[model samples]
Target: MSVDPEDIEPTYRWPVPPAGGWTADDLDRLPNLPPHTELIDGMLAFVSPQTMFHSRAIDFFTWHLHSLAPQGLEVVREFTIDIDCHNRPEPDVLVVDEAAILGMEQTRFPAESVLLAIEVVSPDSVARDRSLKPAKYAGAGIPHFWRVENADGRAVVYVYELDPATRGYGAAGIFHARLKVDVPFPIDLDLNEITAKRRRAE
Candidate 1:
């Protein structure tokens, strides 16, 4: 029988890391898996079940990005990025060059090849998405990052760009209603369309 996503638990704790630490190869040995699993600093972190609102937001943003992305770039969802031997994160949405994506053999893409990494926050992922990932992605030298948060049923986009000297991201702006930015590419997004409310049950 198919399992309802909501019925599943939020996170799974993997066993302690081995002497050499958890690597991408370790992920390959696992059996059937859910849609999202990440290795952060040698620890396995399972993504929580997504709410209808969260899933819709991802689809909306991904569609807009696909439509507006620059030539030779493609947007993908939940793609694993190998930041290092001990750190592989799966962002909610990511952008990478078509050529780089085509050349990749392993399931995970090299962090340096990504143009932008995006995360859409859920209640369970607030800390990792808001703070942990920004620092991790910046340290890996990914040039751009975007974070989407849902507040009171509206979507908010936070933009960031890497500062090469510090290897960290500097805030560009927080956008609502409309999102406009120039980094990795130029694009404008309508948050209203992206975060349209779902129908309520009677």
Candidate 2:
């Protein structure tokens, strides 16, 4: 069920970006840009459709983060962080200050308000999840980041903490079955739940 990236050009009429490429604010104004479209270095980066593993992993993190996060922190999914004039990439899940709750109408969070940003790696976004986006988040001073990948159909999370001295992230740990962290707040989770389907309420 995966379409070749080259095939999109023939079947889709993408919005024309402006001179010097699209800005962060332009994400709201552009018509025809697909949902979850991101601005990277002033260029639009379209994402592939989600797999069930992606959705389940997001739910697992969102639910646990919501239940355990300290006061004045909130968990949000698929919201863009306004990094600067030209870059606005959306993380799959984010933890931000309660101040980021500007209102129900708020469309994006400022990068400074983000405490932790997490990306569940998609087959199409492996490069961004592993490198590009993390560098951008680090440059904006977001304190923590986690990249989750499917390893033999299980979620394997790579945890990172920002190093202000270098403006880059340092690896904290890699969790195959359990995720335990103390920075930003204490959090312990059973990573296996990401692969287990939630029972439908009948």
Candidate 3:
């Protein structure tokens, strides 16, 4: 029988250790993370809880990104990337440079030359994406980051530009319906379509 997406269990959320710490071995040694858990900054962040809005946003963004088919770029969904020996984050959406993809063996995007990384905020992941993951992504020199917030049957998309000095995302802007970005490539994203699909009753 096919597993129901809504029936899935969520993972645990805990405080992250200090920076410049925790090797890949340390991460691998932990009990196998449930499909919903994402590793961020050497800590486990629970995700994929009961949130249709969040899931819809991710689906919509990926659809729009894939339609672009912009040369020299690739859009990946839920793929783990080894940002460093200590950090491997599976961002919701990734737009990576073609060169970065050429070196990968399978289903991985290199941290470097990642033009944009996007995360859809969940009750369990807001802190990690807004605070922890951005620092790690920026430190690895990722140029841009996007955050999606679903509230009150509406969705908001936030844009963040990476600052190497701070190694964090600087909030650039927010969009309610449509979001456009020149980086990674030139294309427009229609968030309204995604949100509308989510709001439609089952």
> lDDT per prediction?
0.85, 0.93, 0.74
Window of ten residues with lowest summed lDDT in model 1: 99-108
Residue 127 of model 3 has an lDDT of 85
Off by over 4 Å in 2: 1-12, 197-202
lDDT of 2: 0.93
Model 1: residue 145 alpha-carbon error in angstroms: 0.5
TM-score of 2: 0.91
Q: Estimate each model's TM-score.
A: 0.86, 0.91, 0.75
Report how far residue 80 has shifted in candidate 2, in Å. 0.3
lDDT (10s digit) by residue, model 2, range 1-202: 9999988766666777788988999999887778899999999999888999899999889999999999999999999999999999999999999987889899899999999999999999999999999999999999999999999899999999999999999999999999988988999999988897679999
Instruction: Note the residue pairs that clash in candidate 1.
Output: none
**Candidate number achieving the greatest lDDT relative to the actual structure:** 2
Model 3: CA > 4 A from native: 1-22, 25-32, 48-50, 102-107, 164-167, 197-202
Range of the 10 consecutive residues with the lowest summed lDDT in candidate 3? 21-30
